[model samples]
Target chain A: MEERQRVRRPGGRAARVGAAVHQAVTDLISERGYGKFTVGDVAARAGVADSSVYRRWGNLEALLTDVALTRLNARSPMPDTGSLAGDLHTYAANVAREITGPEGLALLRLAVALSGNGQQGRRALDDLLAERARHLQSMLDRAGERGERAPDALEVLDHVMAPMYIRVLFGLDPLTPEYVDGLVDRLL
Target chain B: MEERQRVRRPGGRAARVGAAVHQAVTDLISERGYGKFTVGDVAARAGVADSSVYRRWGNLEALLTDVALTRLNARSPMPDTGSLAGDLHTYAANVAREITGPEGLALLRLAVALSGNGQQGRRALDDLLAERARHLQSMLDRAGERGERAPDALEVLDHVMAPMYIRVLFGLDPLTPEYVDGLVDRLL
Candidate 1:
């Protein structure tokens, strides 16, 4: 009886619902693009009550922000290959896979759209950037501790992250292993 | 009589209408964002008949492509200050200003949104990229002629243009003169 009760905990159910809603939001944005769907649509797709989404996220923008932040957090953790160069290469490759993955472009577009969308949206974008920056900083900090002269976080952002993102967004070229390594090499 | 006839020529009126329509489209995109407005809305804002827009551009995506291409062509001509470094610095500064300008973010978001939309949108994005690439190639060619070992156009795009675009799109730090120069210096 106790085992069954633990399995049916309220927190577990809530988490399952949250995952479903996030997935639904991603799928909708991928298929239909941003600003075309409503909270009700998301709820319908996730098979949850509309009020549940509203109670949790407050509004569509908040919900979108949550989805973006959650996805960023869920991406592969920052690498620790014992050398700055190896770590950067692995980190860049992970990012390349995520952004070029099936739902990557949609999330990227969501971030861009949110930034331009007035106050709340801009705040959401800032939060998203802050999270990514935090992860990058930790990696850089580790390099610093190892007595390696690591480039600043901004350098990695400007040189490595920015190019990969722009290329994917524009469909310019494949983010091949050679190309990803080339960015890390240049930055180093 | 001849001057009046020239002023009132049909082609002159058509050009005026095109300008108004383009401005209307840009303004709408800036204010409301992509996919939020319609052809009728654009025509109403531009003070033209709906049929007029349809006859000229055929669809919203085409109209958007035209706006992006036209704006790219209308930017300041490629600078030839007798050196690749000078040319890249000036060019990066110009891009920084344009992308940070009042209408810049909206246009960029439009480009991103269009790229993910479908086949037509992908083609439109390709056209925009090709136009920009042509201008970049000309500047590189000039440097080659001067016996300066110029970096290829892709190098410039990857190092300079990509960083600026990604920065502006995410509302990151301002594209300061120093920052723009740093990208050029690194590329050279």
Candidate 2:
């Protein structure tokens, strides 16, 4: 499902170059987890010059941060199923499906790793996490529009997201619909 | 903080060799992260014969699994304050401390990566995750003793644990005591 959806496009020749490089970044990341790719590898794979890649993004870490930030901006279509709980369940199920797959888990594990990098890397990761949090907040706000009370919304968000991630990244259990429903029911 | 405490002692002769090799495993894992260590490295670092290390653990994955399981057995001292929420609160704070540190995060990331391994590798990680779940369940059971009603405790457990791990592993935010206090208060 995720494979069919490419990174959302930006305009112009520079955007074309950016899209090409980002595509190479995603492919290499999925093919070989984090810590294995280099700027030269991304350049060669994207058919862009190594100098162009380096001139554009400084180093491998910067390129990864750029790709991650760009990917966040092209965010996946979020669930909006009337109630906050319903939306979160849909979101959890989607997360479970993604994490259990190689590509999704690889990107996430890579995110966790990059989150630990020094300064600029940390800021990039912060933006990425905040992007996800915003989706949760929006879902709850929609619930509020429907007249449901969702005070302490952030804590509720934690209950919804944390478990799905733990399952996806840890493989403790199958992310069955039953499990996600149980979580949504309990938290709500 | 973790550097101050080694995996607790198990027993004699074979135990001595096991301790040395496990120590080597921890050090190499911290320094190089995953997929970068070898049996030969462990053997040389632990001053054991390479043949001995191979005979006992067979391969790197198996060795990692063994080391991780042994570390699990020497689990952290459980938080046992009178109230269920109080104990969970303490537990969450301790978890925040452990996970934010380099050594703890390295081991956990390694576990997540290894959980994707085939058969024996998966089983080892499964056992490791189950062991932690058992600790949480035990805490809930004790809460039951105090007559605190936590229906569907596994989901409740997720509410308790998921956010902390997500924050620590993803660097989403600081795992402050106040943050943990919020989780406990919201859930209980």
Interface RMSD of each: 1.0, 2.4
Q: What would the per-residue lDDT of candidate 1 be over residues B9-122, giving only the tens digit for each residue?
A: 566877888899999988998888887789999999999999989987898888888887787567747888999889989999988888886588778888888788789888
Assess every candidate by TM-score. 0.91, 0.72
Residue-level lDDT tens digits of model 1 in A60-105 = 9889988987886688589999999999999999999989965988
How much DockQ does model 2 earn?
Answer: 0.43
Report the Cα RMSD per candidate.
4.5, 6.8
Best by DockQ: 1
User: Whole-model lDDT, candidate 1?
Assistant: 0.87
Q: What level of docking quality does candidate 1 show?
A: medium
Candidate 2's displacement at residue A32, Å, is 4.8
TM-score of chain A, every prediction, order shown: 0.90, 0.81
Q: Which of the numbered candidates is closest to the native, going by highest TM-score?
A: 1
